[model samples]
Target: MSNGQGMATEGEVQEGLTVEEIAFIHGHLHDNVGELILKAGKFKGLDVKKLAAQIQSRQKALKKLPEWSTNEKLIFPPALSVEQCSSEATAHYKASIVSGDRLIDITGGMGIDCYYMSRSFTDTHYFEQQPEVASTAAYNFTQLGATRIHVHAGESLHALHDGLNADWLYADPARRDANKEKVVRLADCTPDVAGNAALLLNAAPHILIKTSPLLDIDLASKELQKLKEVHVIGYEQECKELLFVLDREMPEQDFKIKVRMIDAAGQPIHELDFDREEERSAVVSYAKPLGYLYEPHAAVLKAGAFKTLCTRFNVQKLAMHSQLYTSEEYVNDFPGRSFRIVAVCKPDIREISQHIPGDKANITARNFPAKPEELRKKWKLKDGGDHYLFATTLADQSKVVIVCVKPI
Candidate 1:
């Protein structure tokens, strides 16, 4: 249950990386990491462990942080930090909204967000409790050509508790409790955001907190006072982070939640802003599978925008409980996958066998009794093909299987 303190051990890293180590890492940048690991015994001068970390992390950065990944001199943390830290896409999204004279990021793990967020501010503070992580961020910030960030090593809340007002206060607190357990609630996290929001507001009027995507938005809004907006961010259709913005002067009546869907390049594909009333009164019409099936993107689904999806796209809900949608006319700009109805039938073993001619076909389920694996076993369908099967509940609460072709 440990949340894992993903930092490098003492002696594993130095104050400054050596020239030879940097050269060794860059020389093997394009080489296969697995083959290099197999031949590590042959390299007598290079520290294979550090080289492996550089290679592994660089491979991830190439895709995760394309702009920063090319810098050969940047110091990368252990695998845990590399995997857990915010991707360049999410960091850029944070940068787009924040603008001010000064800003501070308290839980600066790999400093990815700090580096990007500094773009919108004149001065920035990067704080981390771990000295090694702080030091690494300091060095990489310079190597990556960042000019504004001031790296501060220590507990962030204590460092800024002196009542210095900044334009923006940002934090992505460690989502683990003292017992090393993974914490889902904001109060259970280190720095206890729920308890310290008042204390933090004393330093800045506006605060942005990043939390787990699994956190319930409705519950968070109730627990966090002065909460202004909840942003559900997604990259390549996969939901990544839940960003909460709180303002000191904004009243609850003026509060609004915004959901943004972004692609891999941090471009917004779709966005919606709604009040609590809109969510409560939003009505969705349900019908059976029509000419086409529209599946909302992951971010919209996480934001619980079922009614909004139907209203925006001019689609009908397949069932009240089912999140799937359908429309008679093709909606070209639908956020998620769109499928043309090839056929529809009850999910009988013999019917499904007849619907899908091939043994291999992609399968999915929505508001259905059985899992994908179970359906595959029952129908003896393999896992690929031009065809796709969706097992969903109709508006009448009847179990039905949908056979669909590629997007219209």
Candidate 2:
């Protein structure tokens, strides 16, 4: 199954490639190669090495598919364009459908957000600083079937200061400096959030700003007034991004925070909300630590609703130091999964070795002095297990041990 140039031809690639092979190619392909392969056909097996070899052989030819031509207007490769559009579109779609008319995208990166929102609104305005990015966006939008979008190729604040009116203002500032240093906070960007607030406030009745997940939520909430909702999106329990929605017309009520998890099927698996008062630790014991330990999601942690969660689950916090809660019988319908306590030992390696002499052990250290991986190495533990051991501090501020194993 090979093409004339030592690569697989369209027919051969489709016939020979596995799902995993296609995924690898999808991940590594350049815009041109990706466009060629996708148009050739979808691959459906697991021969990644063979697919890589094919791609390597055809690298030169693939480069000739089409450069990002502003005039010719070829199809934007799904690999390059779709990845960006998926994230951008999700944000734009969410904002557009949330009861709004006019939309102002302040930091229009590639214009994918603007492209999608254009369909849902009567007018859509996009602002971008880089000339190349702006041009690329213009071209990309045309390729994506968007013709009516207005691109403001300049500084976002400048465009905003020029008196743009919109029902919803969207901004995704450049979080990287010229030297490629990552900007972790609003203050680190070129036009800091504070500096651009006035312009944003005047531009629209509501503003939706996308910030790095690394930014401290507490600091961001405090700095951005009129912030009504904080959303943390996670995939398969791994946190991805944070969204802050600010509304100028509405007075500040109790802060509402939502944590959402989307599964591979594109369905929301979980959506939990916390009100202002629920974000506090409580003083009651819901239930005693049984055989399992459960750690809630990051949004739960951020909401600080340990008491509420404990009360709802009928569980008790393992200890003051441990953020995880424990219950005796298995709560099959728990929001977060549950794990059974398999083994428990002190932080001392000698003691740990005595309890579990195997070469592999799963180690988790929370509220303990040592890091998890470091302790794993110190105890000469390899990784393989349904077994989980936690080194933490008890409610009385005493060092304690926790061992977890899921019930069958």
Candidate 3:
């Protein structure tokens, strides 16, 4: 499998790290990179910089790509590649979406997604424009015993132009540009997925496009006329990826959105699925602070399921725009954090102290006039305690501080 560049391809590139380099990386895996750089001269004839980078990347992988991180035989890519690559959880989730005889990854950066997704297909084609990156990924696939993935070191569009077809096509376009500035628009991304939608649909029945979390799902869905589904994924309370699945035969304006939040241990804590029409037609009740307060996870919020959440969980919103929910009875299966309302008081320190005498609580401001930091200063409250103070507006348009405690 020559990469067709005349330069060294996967079959002919340097065969991963040298034994000495591997040993050095494994030995200093827990050491600080800066210290290792300072000791570079003492360790002669070693690519100290590269070794340090591998160590850092491995450290990060311990959490993001645990299975890969433990395999010493696999050569890690540069830090940026590791950072940009999808986590093991996300990659596996993607693999579960579609499966067939043939698959193609048009923007295979580190080949993480391709390697995992290839399990569901008989064969997978990985195309990367960067020769060196593609070569390293090819070597890694070999080390991981992924014999079904074929590496193509060139422009992805060129590969498609060459008449490569598949049952499924995948792409995670580079979100950052040549200048390293982050871009959120599909057109700004490398390979211009939006512009090449037709070519992709012609190449495969299904096309899965992964974009930055900052992407506007509704806008992107409208942009990609064949969009069939959108997935908003969150990890560690932060939105991470926006996945759009396109089908050649799918009808327009009929896409559904799936929002999921994964905890630190890579376990999904909450998941909600709804379409735009469902959201628009859903009705939610409103009320003052009740016995329990619920805050939906980042993914659900990003997916804009405010009304759906209310109807689904039988809860009431504090206000139309508050995005905070309340229920007289606790909903154990609610998708977000739950707290028992201790007291609802006026936004005065004296009234707040009457309930929260300790003056220590985790403060969150939702649809409030002041920021959390500013409120913290004005109320003379220390951060971090079992108590949580929510300063938000009620249905009657009155601001109040709701003190809450985690339900035992």
Candidate 4:
């Protein structure tokens, strides 16, 4: 809720408060958090300001991660700290990737990733620049009954200069600048994971770097060397994080990009991997909208998988650039939503009105001249119901509106 990094005095865990007092603070943090400082002036023996900060952090984290939110003993930093932490789902995905003897998190914020990542490894080192955050992480780890994580409060680079080696060295750089503005480029992120690639590679055989979901995958591969694989992770069909895993001994040319979706309807996981050459050389058929419409998952789209998607699904691309796909038969296991074509007509109100048989319909545009808002106004249609309209361009260079309906 609150954006500012409010009081972080929770770093002094159990120092001034007794067990009963800490228990009281945790009990009211759920509902009475806002009123505690206002009415009581002090929540038991805990600082009211600190209690408020913890409540705000916990409330925000609850939506993103219910596991951490329900933990009564978990110590959270200010709003900014919890805001930047990874969701439990994404962190669990990252932890599933590597399993070894040791792990070192170069940039630990709320330590959500490390908290899960440490489970796979026998030993883990969490390094954070902020003392309060680091102390909070240490306290939280203990509360979670962790026994292997070694919390280090300082710069991770300085700690790694001693030639420490591990199975994995991970870094999720701070994407914000001094002005609190977002830094889109990898080089701009604090700790400069791309700039100090050589040093990081030397610290571990495998290095995992998490970047913003908007980061260009191709550009990042060029910026960093010894690439092993790039993971595009999504949750509930929405792309969230871009993970790059670099192997010290691996060659750059022999790398693959794996696009993973956490939820694919009833299926638990959906994954597709392709190399640069394969994607470049892939030949996908193109055709007009025939029997059904297929849309790739969000993670697949983010992986620059326009061409390769059609090849994998054995479908035809609507156009060279347009990501819409079509096939003569139904694809039972298609990764995305499937819609059967009801009617394909030109962008004429007379034809659309006659066939609609409904008051409102959902609209989608692919490779069209006008945006959704402009087209909605021009089409004179309401926005609701199960009906769907697709305004797109065909391969023959014709702009048409295709009426698509969900399969019952």
Candidate 5:
């Protein structure tokens, strides 16, 4: 498989291949083994048509591997998985700056989001700390005919500190710890939120920070002064990451705080509105679960509209467990599905150990101050069960347990 210009050699076919060759392989190879061989044989120029035929021939004898797909239908780079790409795309789309002429992405991982957002801006600057990633991005941009884009390899904060100006700054901070552990909170990462925020906000009028799905929105919002928007994204009702936007210049009237959960097609699955003047306390309380239970969408939870949600759904709060609410009437128009509470307990370890006498149990602890894994371990519970035990805290500072099942 050699071309005229130093194309096909044994080493090239066996080990070294250019990115263009890899892209060809990705498009033609159907199986993981074929993909691996093509990746290994990178230096050589593999025939795309031949590889496709080879893949078709090999498929007859090979066992099928698990195929991975996402509800978001996001297309990812070969280096990243579909889930990661979908998540990054959703966050970038939601945090997009429509008013910006020039945009700067401080941490462009695979150039997926950068490619999508660059369409709205006149010019785009993408910075990647890793040399390989930066090179890949440069090649990809050139191949895509994106002449107005520049890919730089260096530290983002240092580059920003050197005086880069843009209408918007987007950053995805490294959330990995020193021990190579994944951390969810702002305090967990290197150059923490404050440090990154200082550099990012200094470069642009608006900065968008993408955070973990497990992060505490209240805590994150409290940490950033100019935080104007918080979004909790979801794909097909499954909660994903939380996005925070901080604006340097305030609008004439503060934009109403919005909580939006979007689907794979970039449609709003659920939305909740909040203002600076809205109260965070629990609102109206209805009688115990009568016909249905309404769980607010992620955006609603991020907005901390416990009272507003309850009022909107005509539900009652289950004390202080802000994660859940109860109602008697069936509100078909509610964003979240309705569930029925079958039982409630005090969540005493002794009571739980004594009352539950089964080989399998489904344990979920929310706002009750106990970790789910710890509770599951302590209770010796297993999965694949119909019952859901909710260990949550009440407004009275009391820990309680509620057993629930999906409503018919």
Candidate 6:
């Protein structure tokens, strides 16, 4: 139905799931959806397709949103939303960073961030363009006893245009275009956060934007002149989200970049804060293969801390371009994977075999021409073993395979 503003709202979400449907969903929560669909005819008077979708979404949520997934009464949205929604680990991280009297999430897709963030604020407003999804989130919030969050079904920009203001403004713009293709640039995303930076700052002094990990932090900072902090967040060694915090009052020229690595339990593993000037001005020493090798975590690498690693960890860089680090004395507290060097030699298969003396070894290519698989095939090495081989270029611009083993 048309909302009379040239925008068509989807039909109101189902008032509620039927008792039988709920029962079916709970009973088959752990069942394989494909298998259940195969035997759909066995269940009478049940919407097998609908229940199957619910089960699928809930199954995904069990790991991503463990807190809410355990409550059988809470309904789930479509599989895409469940997959795209922020994991409990990241949501908790967002909530811990900012708090205020009033908070507004303009691009509230499934309300995962909004719900978690609401706990830190007195009042939270969630706006979503999709009517059905918004209503579903509202129902879920009620079921989860999140009374502090208020859901509004409409375009987020329209909500802001209508004089809605808050102490903190948050947005996780949709990365998909009208054709359902993924986009990386902030301007291409829905809500056009880059274009409306001024408007958003007018609505709220502070704004937090969650963007795709592929986005360049430097480019984004340049786009949003009021950028305050760039948080490069990693979950379980994978870069999950790039959060940019903007403040109207803070000067844009002196923004800081932070890299945080969190475990699956939403606990911090390692965190480092540095500025571009520090990274650029830091002195880094280069050395050949050393006793220990350290590889920075994904988040650290994504934040472009190539030379900063040396200054921060007191390690030597393998090469100017190679991200691998080395130290004569083992640095047990390194932020990324650590390895003890076993042997360093040419990338020749004969030399590798002489050093490894095994058929299988973990292969990693850093600043090397060949990929892991190509090198693996050429060197006749299998995928897994206690041995870890880093085929990288040394400081002298010579290719070498540095055989390493995990410290026991």
Q: Rate the local accuracy (lDDT) of all candidates.
A: 0.80, 0.61, 0.85, 0.79, 0.60, 0.85
lDDT computed for candidate 1: 0.80
TM-score of 3: 0.92
Residue-by-residue lDDT tens digits, candidate 3, 1-408: 355221236455556688888899899999999999999999989989988989988987888998899888677887777887899888877887879999999987887788889999998888887777888787788778888888888787876777889999998987546676656578777777888988888899899999888777877776786888898988876788889999999865589899877754445777788998889999888988889999888788889898999889999999999999999998998887899999999999898887775878899999999999999999888998788899999989999999999987
Better model by TM-score, 3 or 5?
3
What are the runs in model 5 whose C-alpha is more than 4 Å off?
1-92, 95-97, 176-187, 190-193, 196-199, 251-257, 275-279, 298-303, 339-408
Those runs of model 6 whose alpha carbons end farther than 4 Å from true positions after fitting are: 1-14, 176-184, 354-358
lDDT of 5 by residue, 1-408 (tens): 111111111122212334564465455446565455556555365654444443443332122111111111112234322234434337445535444678888877766567667767787888777665566556555555566677776676777778978988776666665464555467775446554666677789887777767777766666665787776666555566667778887553344556666654456756766664564454566343344555666556655676777656666776655467776666666666566667667776566544455746677676778887887877677764766777876666667776666776
Per residue, candidate 2 scores C-alpha lDDT tens digits across 1-408 of 111111112232212334555556546655454454554544454444445444543343242222222222222333333332335324443544344567777776655456655667776777666654565565556555565566666776765666768888877665546665555567776556656676788888777776666767777777776788877766555565677788776587445777666554334676677765764644546333567788777655654566777667677886664777787777665556568876556567676555554776677777888888887877678887656677887776667666666667
Q: Which candidate, 1 or 5, has the higher lDDT?
A: 1
TM-score to native of every candidate shown: 0.90, 0.70, 0.92, 0.86, 0.65, 0.92
Cα displacement (Å) at residue 307, model 2: 3.8
Q: Higher TM-score: candidate 2 or 3? A: 3
Residue pairs with backbone atoms closer than 3 Å in model 3 (clashes): none
Per-residue error (Å), model 3, residue 306: 1.7
For candidate 6, give the lDDT: 0.85
For every model in order, what is the number of clashing pairs? 0, 12, 0, 0, 6, 0
